[model samples]
Target: MITTRVVKILYVLALIPISLFSLLMAVYGLAWIDDSAAFGYLLLLASPFVWLFQVFATRIVLEFVINQFKISEYLRAIKDKG
Candidate 1:
């Protein structure tokens, strides 16, 4: 079984890419501001929402994975008892 410290590290690591992606979107949107203000503003405004949604989704997935591991561990304990 993996240690809790490792799982915490992995969870934090997973968030890094998501944060980078959101930053890129904001940068791209800023770059486009001069050419198309509306589109640029749209992207800028949407970036945060997108980040929030992605984070929420990622959290759900991680929780599911953690739950699965816990379930398996519990099952193993049960089997051993029997």
Candidate 2:
């Protein structure tokens, strides 16, 4: 069984890259503002939505992983009982 501390650490690890990528995207978009106004506006506007979708997807994946672990733990318990 995975401990709560380990799960928390995994969650944080998973979020780190995502958060960094989002920040980078925002920065890049800001930098582009001087070159192309329309494109820069698009990126700036889309960055938040992209970040949100990424976060949502990550959450779903992490939940699935955690559920798999829980299911396996439960199966193990059942096997031991029987």
Question: What is candidate 1's lDDT per residue for 1-82, written digit by digit as tens?
Answer: 6745666787799889989999999999999999999999999999999999998887788778888889999999999999
Q: Which one is best on lDDT?
A: 1
The alpha-carbon deviation from the true structure for residue 47 of candidate 1, after best TM-score superposition, in angstroms, is: 0.6
- Off-target runs (Cα >4 Å) in candidate 2 are none
Q: TM-score for all predictions?
A: 0.86, 0.82
11: Cα error in model 1, Å: 1.5
Find the candidate with the highest TM-score and give its number: 1
| Least accurate 10 contiguous residues by lDDT in model 1 | 1-10
Q: Evaluate all candidate structures by whole-model CA lDDT and list the values in order.
A: 0.89, 0.83
Q: What is the number of backbone collisions in each predicted candidate, taken in the order shown?
A: 0, 0
